[model samples]
Target chain A: MTNPIVLDVNNLAVSFQTFEGDVKAVRGVSFQLKKGETLAIVGESGSGKSVSTKAINRLLPVKNTLIESGEILFEGKDLLQLSEKDMQKVRGNDIAMIFQDPMTSLNPTMKVGKQIAEPLIAHIGLSKEKAKARAIELMDLVGIRNPNEAYKRYPHQFSGGMRQRVMIAIALACEPKILIADEPTTALDVTIQAQILDLMNKLKKELDTSIIFITHDLGVVAQMADRVAVMYAGQIVEVGTADEIFYNPMHPYTWGLLASMPTLEVGKKQLYTIPGSPPNLLHPVKGDAFAPRNDYALGIDFVEEPDLFQVTETHYAKTWLLHPDAPSVIPPEEVRRRKEKYQTVRMGKACGERIGGGAIGSGG
Target chain B: MKKYIAKRLLTAIPVLLMISIAAFIMINLAPGDPTNLYVMPDATPEQMEATRRALGLDQSYPVQYMRWLTRALRGDLGISYSTRYPVLPILVSRIGPTVALMGTTLLVSYIIAIPLGIISARKQGTWVDTLLTGGAFIGVSIPNFFLGLGLIYIFAVQLKWFPTGGMLELGGNASILSVLHHLVLPVAVLSTFYIANMTRYVRSTMIDVYGENYIRTATAKGLTKQVILTRHGIRNALIPIITIIGTDLPRLVGGAIVTEQIFQWPGLGRLTILAINQREYPMLMAITLLSAVVVLLVNLLVDMMYAVVDPRIKYD
Candidate 1:
């Protein structure tokens, strides 16, 4: 049986009003999260992945942001319709967001322990003594050893990995149903990144909390997401299970993003590349924003924006090539080979689970 | 670091020596000698010469400069002309009022500016921020004397709350309350510009610091706004404020001059002016040197405060 939806974002479009012009940031984006699933939104900078998530919490400056039409339903309430004060209450209570730079997300002057207890006091109405004990427990839960001492320390005293762990602790302090982690590990080194990801995976399992992971790293999405949404030029172009996005992406932009991934091949040192830069949002496009750079674009593809067309039972792609009457094509064989590797990871995760209830499922 | 201090001290000595020489010349260059101002016009030239000789004004410029410099090196700043008493005693008697006024102004300005600046910066681009910016504009545009007179009109004349001038009621003696009452107009006059300047500095510093990565993290981590303001923004903002306070030492002293005159507070500024008007070279020189030295000492203090405020900064 499917878990109930915890958060639903429908047809959300965000625009920035500036002296230069209106910069259309996020457009017609929609997605949902099951009660405890990790839904990864992958896209490059300026793709509105960050903006899309910030809108849910009302974190952006109201003067510049115009959320033209959207319904951000979280546990049945329209988050977008709430006042900032009301939203701030909801934030860190029911829906918490962890930013990219872990160090930047935590206040420098406050003790780590106190910062963790803030949301609990504000939202949970916990007393100081009880909250302090719980804060230390959280610090220990997030893999921080010597939790009692760690709580007394400031943000500066913690390492990057430790700081991110602190951020995770604070995010979980209120036990929010949804945790929006925006590139939580992008600022960390590879080894620390792995640790943070592992910690997050463990926490999600333990807490049974859903997470909306915003990142441009396809590799991270492959490893973390149960479902994936590939955003480009402020639109959700193609979205599906990790297998479909990696093995059988229907849009040219997704193909480019996959092709652009740095392979681990030794010494051959070939650099994969996308042909052109992202389309400028200042004066975006009348038709397909990606058409100008897409090599296989046809006459119709250049003039009309493709509606979201069904590709599979759980897959959708917003590209003209996905149209029923259009000519069909497949990704390169190498891309297919990468999909086989991804399938193996899923298989590995499933087999590991056979050992016991404690085993991780096919989420790797 | 020692080399830097040595260089500053070395550069300072020549500037001070030149000032001493200039003071000596201006004091002697008057058409009628200072002694003549004291003696009757019918007195013999011999009597005037005796007076000049007794006061050591009959000596050559080099001899006079040497005498004063030697005496200054020995910790004596010569006698006052108007009072016929030692300049140090006169300065000591009057230093209380000027210092009190300046000290009060400095305290008030900081107390006012810090919160105002933080508030202004926090709501930048909003009406509150615009209002503060506009207020600072008025503060910067107004002359200190005008503001002083304006305060005099409102508090002294119209409301009759504070005295318009003087350090105290004439026979009130130097009690703390009387001193403060007398200090009102002068300190406010001196601090108006300082508070305005400090607010602008504080606002800009806070704005920059508010955007710091750590502040964002702190807010996200759920610290209270007050905690973030004091611990995150205020501590960092104070570094620049300390530096500005250090550099503005001269202005802080110069500002007291006009206020002193207006209030008849009988401070160093008053002493300097009286010496200048009466051709008292020694007293003028002592007051100028004393102001410079106070400023120099404040620079040392500021360097120390920098380290206190920011651990990253160290003065070797």
Candidate 2:
């Protein structure tokens, strides 16, 4: 059974009023985060994945950013409509966020324990001593050796991976219902990235907190995400279960993304890259924002913006290719090979009867 | 930390010695003899030589420096040619008034500028920011002498609200009130520049600090705007601002020459100008040495403060 929805963002549009003009950063994005599941929003730089998640907690800068339209429904409240005073109570208590670039994401002047204790003191109204105790506990929970000693240390004293763990500790301090991690491991080493992802998975299971993981790395998505939302040019182009997005992605952009993944197959002449850059958001997008870059763009994609068409009960793709009247096109070879490899692995596992039935069922 | 301090202090010895040598040489090289004002113009060359000898100016450069350094080491800064008094005692006496003036100026400037700067950074492109920025620019651009004269004219001369200048009102009792009344115009002039400078520095530094990822993290933690600005923003911004303030410490004794001149306030700046005009070698050298020591010590203090303010900084 599906977990209950913890966060429902509907038609969220955000724009930044810059000197040139309004740059539409996030254009009509919608997604639901279920309890205890990690929902990864994957995209290239400036694709609005970070912006959308930042908007969830109303953390966007007040001076220039304008939420054009949206309703961030959390619990029974529309967070967008809540006053900043009320929103403060919701933030770090009901919802918390961890940012990328652990090197700069923590206060250099503050002790790590105090940074972690800040939310607890501010939200839970814990006494300083109690908060310190809890903060030490959290430091330990995040796998920091000698939590008591680490607490008194500053961010600079910690390594990049350790700093990120401190960041995660700070985010998890209040036992928040929703944790929005914006590329939490992008700035870390690859091996450390895996460890952080594993820690997050472990924490997610232990804490039962819903996570909105924003990242550009698909490998990270495969590691931690229960579901994935593929963003492109300020819009969610496709969203589905991890299995569907990897094995049976329908959107051309998704196909391009899957094709771009480097493989170990011998004599694969060159890696496939999606041709052209994302559309600039300065001027209004006339039709499909991705039409210029999309090799599989139909004639109608040039004149009309395609709606998110349903593929399966749990899958949806915003592309004209998903329409019934549209011409059928085959996915790239790499994507098909990936799906076949997964099926073979599944069959092998099934025949061995070593893995659980539930694990096999969940793979679909 | 103690070792670091000791090392810094040790390094300061050569630095102070070099400063003393430079000051001694520069003063001797300057036009006019210290004996010029004492001796008659038509006095014989032998008489002039006698006056120079008595004042210890006839000695060779190295010999004179050695004599001065030895005497200074014994707390004897020599007698001032102009005052006929010991240079160290005069400098010590002047320190009180100058410190009072500069200390008040620093306190008043930081107290006013810090809050305004924080407000300016927080309110950034708004009209409030524009007004404060414009005011700071005016404060920075205007000459302190002119500002001093303007205040003297309006408050002291026209309104007759305060004394025109001096550490205490002429013929008045040396009460704190009288001293404060005399302090108004000079302090106003001196603090204007500091307030303007510090406000701009604090504003720019804080604006940059606000952009730091930790600031975003603090905001994300749901701290109030005030808490974030004070705790995160100011705490981080303080690193550079402290450097600015620490560097300004030398100015306390080195004094605001123009401001002191305009106000006629009894401070080291006034003493310095007087010494330069009359070629009071001993007084000038002492002031120069004091200033160098202040600068070196302040540098050490600021470096040490960095360790206190930012745990990331290690003395080692």
Candidate 3:
């Protein structure tokens, strides 16, 4: 049986009031997080991945941002119906969010220890001494050396990776049920990115915390995500388990995203990039937002929005190409080859596991 | 920190010396000798020459500056040419009223500005914000001399609520309460620009601080609005506000020149103007040097305050 749902967001829409007009940032987006699962929402910039997660925590600015519609149900209760006082209790206690830029996210004037201890004091109701002790412990947990000494230092003293580590430590302080990491490793270099991802993976197992990971990097999604959601223009165009999304992506937007990522494996000479910028949100689209960009666009795709079409019990894709009457079109050869390669690697690993076990048994 | 402060103090010595040299040269270059104001027009040429000799006015500029510099180095600013009294004593007596007026105005302006700025920023795009913005614009635009006179007309002449001008009535009781009573109009007049400046600065800074990513981080930490604002918002915004206040310190003393002249308040500003009017070379030089010193000291203090407020800013 699958893990139980911890947080469920349904048909959530968010709009930002700018001087020009009301920009509908997120529209009719729905998703659910399971306990201890890492659900990575992968999309390009301006795809509303970050905005969707920010809306979950009510972190959006109240002055100019308006929650247009929809229910954010955490546990059984609707989070949207809760008061600010009640939201505060749920925010750092039940859910915590880590931001993209570690440099800008941490307060420069405050000690890293105090910053880490903030959530503990606010949500866990820990005394200063106890919170500080826990903060140091968290620092050590995130692999910061001499965490006790490092705790007293300001944010500038730490390197970029170390600062990101501190950010993770702060988020993990309260041991919340859900952790929302919004492009957490995007600002770091490749090596540091791997280290942070590894640390987060370890923490997920240790804490059994569900993570909603938002990223534009498909490579990061491959490593860290259990489930993947491909968002395009404020909507999830495809949702499935990691294997299904990678090995058998159905939506044209998902194909564009995957086609764009560089791989060591042989592919086309030039990188495939989606043509045209995202549509301006000042004026909402009438039909499929990606219809203009899709190379395999059906005539009906431009006039009507397609709902999620079920491919498997756990996989779904929103595209007109999935219709029964639509002409058959094969995935690009490079994507097919990559899928085959992934299958071969997995089969080889399984085969090796059994042979190694048998060889050990015979030797014994 | 001690080393930083010591180094700053060391640097100030040369700065003050340069200021003294500049002030001495500028005052001496100006026309209208102090002897002209002191002597009678009908006095004999011999009498005028004798008076000039006694005052050392006939000496070379270098010779006179060197003499004054030597006395100043020994903590004496020399005797005033216009009054013939010791310059230090006259300055010592006059500085108190200026300090009280400026200090109270500074305190009141900050006390009023900080809250209004915060509230204005919080209530941005609201009627309250618009009203405060309108008020700040008006406060910044009004000429202090005109405002002082207008206040005198309304409160002193029309309503008879306050004394028109001066720190105190001649021969009035020298109690602190009575001094404050006399201070009402002048303080209000002096504070207008400060309030206007500080409130606008603080409002912009607070709004900018509110947009900082750390504020979102603070909010994500489940902090109350009050805690987030005080701990994150105001703390960071305070850096720029302190800067504005610090750079405004020299102006605080200098801007008082016009206001002091209009009210005839017995302060260094009025004294400086009087020295200029009467060609009190020694007194003018002394006041200019003192103003420069105040500016340098305030800059040092502001730098120290930066290290205190921002942990990332180390004095090393």
Off by over 4 Å in 3: A339-364, B44-50, B251-255
Indicate the docking level reached by candidate 3.
Answer: high
Compute DockQ for each candidate against the true complex. Answer: 0.33, 0.82, 0.80
For model 3, how does the per-residue alpha-carbon lDDT over B1-316 read when each residue is reduced to its tens digit?
8998999999999988888888888888888777776679998888888889988899998999899889888988878876679998998788787888788889899999999999999899899999998899999999988998898899999999988778776897788888899888888998898898888999999999998999999888888999899888998998998899898777555548888777778888898888889888878887888789889999999998998998878887
- Report the Cα lDDT for residue B67, model 2: 94
Angstrom error of the Cα, residue A210, model 3: value is: 0.7
Candidate ranking (DockQ, best to worst)? 2, 3, 1
For the second chain, the TM-scores of the candidates in order are 0.86, 0.97, 0.95
Which regions of candidate 2 are displaced past 4 Å?
A: A266-268, A339-364
Q: Which residue pairs come into collision in candidate 2? A: none
Candidate 3 or 1, higher DockQ: 3
Model 2 Cα lDDT, one tens digit per residue, A1-364: 2789999999999999999999999999999999999898999999999899898898899999999998999998999999999999888888999888999999999999999999999999999999999999999999999999998998888999999999999889889999999999988997898789889989999999999999887777777777899999899999988777887788999889878866455145687999999888988997798898888899999999998999878889999998889998877788777667656666664464322211112221
Superposed by TM-score, candidate 1 places the C-alpha of residue A87 at a distance from the truth, in angstroms, of: 2.2
The stretch of ten residues in a row with the least summed lDDT in candidate 1 chain B is: B215-224
User: How good is model 3 by TM-score?
Assistant: 0.95
Ranking by lDDT, best first?
2, 3, 1
